[model samples]
Target chain A: MQYSNTIAILGANSEIGELIANKIAGNYPLLLVDQSEEKLYQLKQLVTEHHPKAQIELAVCSKDASWEADTIIIAANEAAEQASIASKIVEVTTCKTVIQIKKAHLDSATLHPMLPYSKFIAVDWANTTAIVEGKDENSLSITGEIVHMCGLKPLFKKSLI
Target chain B: MFEVFFSQVKDKVLLSEAEQKLVKTFFSPKKIRKRQYLLQEGNICRHLAFVEKGLLRSYNVDDKGIEHMIHFAWEGWWMADMLSFLSIEPSTYHIDAIEDSELLLISRPDFEEMLLKVPVMERYFRILFQNNIISKERRLISSISNSAEEKFIHLSATNPELIKRIPQQLVASYLGITPETLSRIKNKLNKNVPNT
Candidate 1:
């Protein structure tokens, strides 16, 4: 089976997830997944509003939900939920670095026993958003490009860890 | 007790005898009983407390009134809401003693004065902050990435002593799991793995 250059954004209904999707839209074909189909529809409209030509599909993160995409980004409601959804994502794809983009988190380490791959990055997306608000366009673009890179490349192949 | 504190500083930046004395002059020692709060939510954090003996924990009660732990500071660790202490804003967290503890606290003014007087301390503080950032980053990843059982296993493998010392409830909070979840994890471990 040939997987296209499709990027899946889990929890796409989230505010941070939307921002992330909006940033990367038009640049690539997208698959947006969340807890609710209704919310994903709203986000699809929003993404279309910004990138009229961008190809975007949708899925909800239910037990039966699966993505036929190359990469998946998890933007869960909370850390606990993030971990749960991540393990589920791993069950379907050997996709690298399921980046958990969180709004605010105190501190965290690695998932050793669970999916013991070094293909995970716990990003403080709030700080990245702050950069966007601060109008540091260059820095924001660099970060945006880096996140895009994560989507473009399988995490395991580009093992720089 | 202050030996631990001095060693921590000296490890980072070698202080002259006189500069060391100046550093000591800025701090005043205090004792806290177990379960006594050193700083509370809505109160401006005044001093950066350097733990000399015993243990302390920092946490916040969320909207559901569930306590979510921020950290556990033992000997040689510093406890303070850096935002509150620096900005003079109301603290979002509470710091309390987990064991009868001794601390050497320096107010913001004194801490600043020490940094100014003994400029070498700048190196030490910079190292301290860097380590804190690294630790905090690790914690953020671990909290969001690992399962309750995985977290317990990670802690048990890395810092078994911490598990032995801390109560189950607080350990659950630190691991970002419920107390019942923690008990379940321990039960699962007991059954699956041989007790080491």
Candidate 2:
């Protein structure tokens, strides 16, 4: 399941972003943003058909993450754009959790609650989706769920974040 | 050619001479000139390069054509676009030599072959990835939560070698701050905090 409030997915036109939206659109009220309005509408239609319960909205992409969202996913392939979007989100959002969905070095959630964004780079995208679906509070347990979801052994992997 | 890598592998798991030789056979050595690119944006990253000596930096250009530094790999470090390396897609990042460097390059096929040939290498890479993950997590925490001055101070305390080796501009870029901001932060640190 997704977060309680609105979850905005930036770069909805991109392939990876579209894939992530497909995985996550079922559970959350999604605000899909992309460069093309037509593409966003198509995605919204597809997602709504697949997930009738999902509340979805479409908007054209902008550099700023100005909308109110509890969680934000910058799934764009461009690393520079991701940083810019993330920083913009951090600047505008009030105590929101921002998750970067591209391949990055880190898995981060900023510590301060008062400060704007608590960011997490969910680099392991498939496992991240699996873990989120389980909604198991424990991270370790989520890793186990992810391993089970992938149908693979843990193979001595440690300390999933 | 393989001495530095063999030493690293030895630290994690023991490798016999034959195993070491097999591993070495998979990696080819290359010398990169300063400012010469090893990988470019829009091109598939063919090899994961390990720095036997000198420095390499991975970066990207933004919409306004502004360059942002993503990572730096000095001696004993690895530099590659993991997404591109694993998926064989066009890299969003470019890697270039900061200094005239010696590197050991392992192509995708050769890397897979090496893993099969030397089963113990799995442990070596796992440990390396683990270390990378830990540092990245720590870095992300600091970079996100802390102020520029605080970030600079923490970086100086922990990885002084990085600040010493890399230029202030690149350091500022890596920290997601402007050079002027970094300079101001350092100035403030020098004034308020002793031994900065």
Candidate 3:
């Protein structure tokens, strides 16, 4: 399958996710999938506030199925527990990395800062290690490549099984 | 064994046939005697050593002269001082053969040269680094958040073979638990199991 540099932020309305989206949105297509229309509107405004040239679009889950991006990135903490979101993205888009910044399990190893691009944001993303539990090596590699492209580090280990 | 390692790698990173051959060329066979140091502290780690046989460990010595076990490289595992390897700085950790070992060593310059020769290798190494980063992040999170008992259970469930093979002290260090605590936990587990 042909995959583009386009990255979809599953929870784009998120404060940090928006910042992340804004950074990559300039170069590639940025699709924001969120639950709230108001938040989506606010995110669009936020993107325009800093990046007026950014090609940002808002898609609500409440609406019909319209997410058509090559890569899907789940960026919100709330979506971490959403099995539906995970399963849906797994079915459609090719997710490179699922950045779950939940309070319970924070991964800070592969962190990338927004704006001024050089300043390293103190995030758990880069510091947290990934324990990949997958059946095949191709699956792990695909996921690993996505994280690397996002400028995050990842490590591979076999599953308990 | 090399085939097995390559099989594991081929699954994650996509490399062309020619690119794969170039990588296979870097696999220089070397045997390390038990207790021998492949790379020492204060020396730049010039090579990324992949295990072909036997066991090895990478460890850091603290100010108190206590060695903190970073990781163990069993058969078919990769071990290196990543901070030192990537930065080309003097390594603080020492990689030693825990058991008489065999490895395929590739120097940093050769590895980078190989990557340049084959750009797909850059993608492979990038993914490799990411995978390592992910595992480290997960281990740190689990160690900090989970209780000692919980960590033991997790380790036992995940790497029972490692628990059996590695020394208790190293396992304790990996789990971020005291040796005494690990002993106690093991005893508790032993007592809980039926006397068969």
Clashes of each: 9, 0, 31
RMSD of each: 22.1, 19.9, 22.8
Candidate 2 lDDT for residue A36: 80
> Model 1: per-residue lDDT, tens digit, B1-196?
3689999998888988998766766665555568767888988887898988889998999999999988888888898999888889999998888998877777686688889999999889999999999878877787799887888888898778779988889999889888999999898888987668
DockQ of predicted model 2? 0.01
CAPRI verdict (incorrect, acceptable, medium, high) for model 2: incorrect
- TM-score of model 3 (CA atoms): 0.51
Question: For residues A113-132, what per-residue lDDT tens digits would candidate 1 score against the true structure?
Answer: 34333134444554323211
Candidate 2 collision pairs: none
lDDT of 3 by residue, A1-161 (tens): 11133456766766556766655656665678888889888877877777778777677761122224434455665533333465554322211223333223543233221111111112234444444433335445654654455466766654422
Identify the runs in model 2 with alpha carbons over 4 angstroms from their true place. Answer: A1-161, B193-196
lDDT of 3 by residue, B88-170 (tens): 88888888988987666666756777788878778877888898898889788887899998989987887788899999998
Q: What are the per-residue Cα lDDT tens digits for candidate 2 across B55-167?
A: 99999999999889989998788899988989888999989989987777777877898888899998889998999899989999998899988888898998898999999
Task: Look at candidate 1 and tell me the lDDT of residue A156.
Answer: 19
Worst lDDT 10-window in candidate 2 chain A: A130-139
Q: Evaluated with TM-score, which candidate comes out highest?
A: 2
DockQ of each: 0.01, 0.01, 0.01
